[model samples]
Target: MKKIDAHAHLGYIGGWANVKMDVDELISLMDTYEIETTMICVLDNEVAYKAMQKYTGRIEGCVYVNPLEPDCLDLIDKYVKLGFKAIKLQPLRHAYCADSEIVDPILDKAEEYGIPVCIHSGHPPYSLPWQIGLLAERHPNCKVLMIHMGHGHGVYIDAALKMARRYPNIYLEMSGMPMHTKIKEAYDTVGHDRIMFGTDTPFHHPTVEMQKVLMCGVDEQGLEDIFYNNAKKFFDV
Candidate 1:
């Protein structure tokens, strides 16, 4: 079966994680795991842009933006025209509520451009699953990917599933989320295509993430949907 990593980052990241990597490392990791395509969304659009331009089929770029930034609109327009496949938002990092009216413009822009919005979910006071649910509720037409699906907290994880149940447009990504069974649970209850496989590279490993999915009790077709088909459909890879 083929695999498509729904989320990843590139270049040097300083601060808490302190990790650095380029496309070469990403490609090598993918080759080892047989991941056919990956969605790259780092702070610098130029990084993802250059990687996609160079790798073409293997790397799909997602324009990451903090909606509160003044130039976010321009970045979205510029990157969309440059062939980016999606938009990514990190409300936790940017210190803004996910459902803040400030985000509606970006959601509108994503809808207008016909691309999905992948938002970081999990952290409190800003990026909870319910906040993303509110965002989804407000923008019913836009496709919203909840990256990490509420991170490592058990309560947050269950909330993530509940939020997905409430909103059809909200998709859950399995990356840093800890529960293996929730992977199957999400598919069984939230619909098969509503969950995706992501490595959260740098913060997590592909080997670990892949193992989580493999042990999740999802059958072959469900594995294919999570690891390959769902991302293929969402990113148009």
Candidate 2:
């Protein structure tokens, strides 16, 4: 029970790979990896809801939000009330700025529901760590997970850690990010409790993500906190 993947996907998604995944495939993968729980998001909210229903405890839903759409706010209200655990946003994919007021209403709704928020980080113009940091600054009451903790870039990865240090409400989920040493830097400086392990499934494999943390130079308890305790507590699953 020492693993909980904080960022994962369900259904077919149009991307570089146009990757597709069903619940059974995901469940089998989790079993093979010994992951106790995995938080999932999908382009279609129904898929997430159904998976949650089917698996009960194994699948935790992160209601995906696209702020550019008219129903984005309504979707939050709909899904959160339907038992989705947290809010997931991807600004770059939707062509919106993460720090803009367009996302404020979504953040407000998440606060109302008392759930944590996660946003895709790294990539320019929209999803940079500083941009997400501004949103966190505006809404101090909400918990925000900067997913990827700034992807594969060194500068963005460092920026991600800086944002966490700068904002108390900010937390980091290390998935696509490389650099295992930064995890140690983050744990030693920011706080081990603020960092968590994630596998951006269908995009990044768990082996590399887990290896990053394993080599991050933390103790056994620190590994437990990052792999399981932090996300379990943050998502309240």
Candidate 3:
């Protein structure tokens, strides 16, 4: 099976414990795990885009944009031209919700480029599932992937499914949540085609997260779609 990890962090976040993995180390890990490709993003946009340039062919990435940054659009254009697959936003980190005025231009650019935008969803003390749905409604053409399905709060699953049902562009990425039965329920409710496999690696081991999906009793075809084909189709990988 061709494995594609839809989410991963490869650089250091300010003040967080160091997680600085160089391109060679990242490539070696991908090779060891037989990961055909990984979508790399960093908490810092400058560092992340540099990494994207360095690992251009072997990996794809999203530009990390803090909506609060005054030059957010310029940075977005820079990375978009550099061939980033999407924009990575962590609302919690910047204390800005997806619906904030600061984020409007970012969403506009995402629509303009026809690229997807991934948000760190389910991380509380931050944005919630309703915000994701609202954003989807506000930017009907923009493709949004909700990371972790709002992890601690399972309520986001319903919101994600509702938005997905209403809009063809919304997608749910499974990363932090570990309940196998809930994952299966999401598959049944939203259909396997709308779900993407993500390990949230470096935080959780890829092998272990991959195993969680494998043990879900989903048929091989379903597994194939979740693990690779769906992401391939989504990002044109």
Best by lDDT: 1
lDDT of 3 by residue, 1-237 (tens): 668888888754436644456667777877887778888777666666676677776688888889887888888898888788999998988898776667778889999999999988875556676787777778888888888776655566666666666766678788887665555666777777778788776666778778778887788887888888878888777
Q: 2 or 3: which has the higher TM-score? A: 2
- Candidate with better lDDT, 1 vs 2: 1
Error of 3 at 184 (Å): 2.6
Query: Which of the two, 1 or 3, has more TM-score?
Result: 1
User: Cα deviation of 30 in candidate 1 (Å)?
Assistant: 0.5
In model 2, the Cα lDDT at residue 32 comes to: 84
Provide the overall lDDT of each model, using Cα atoms, as 2-decimal numbers.
Answer: 0.94, 0.91, 0.77
- What does each candidate score in C-alpha RMSD? 0.7, 1.0, 2.1
lDDT of 1 by residue, 124-230 (tens): 99999999999999999999999999998999999999999999999999999989999999999999999999998877889999999999999999999999999
Ranking of candidates on TM-score, top first: 1, 2, 3
lDDT of 1: 0.94
What is candidate 2's lDDT per residue for 54-118, written digit by digit as tens? Answer: 99999989899898889998898899888999999999888998899999998899999999999
Task: After superposing candidate 3 on the true structure, give the runs of residues whose Cα lies further than 4 Å from its correct spot.
Answer: 14-20, 157-159
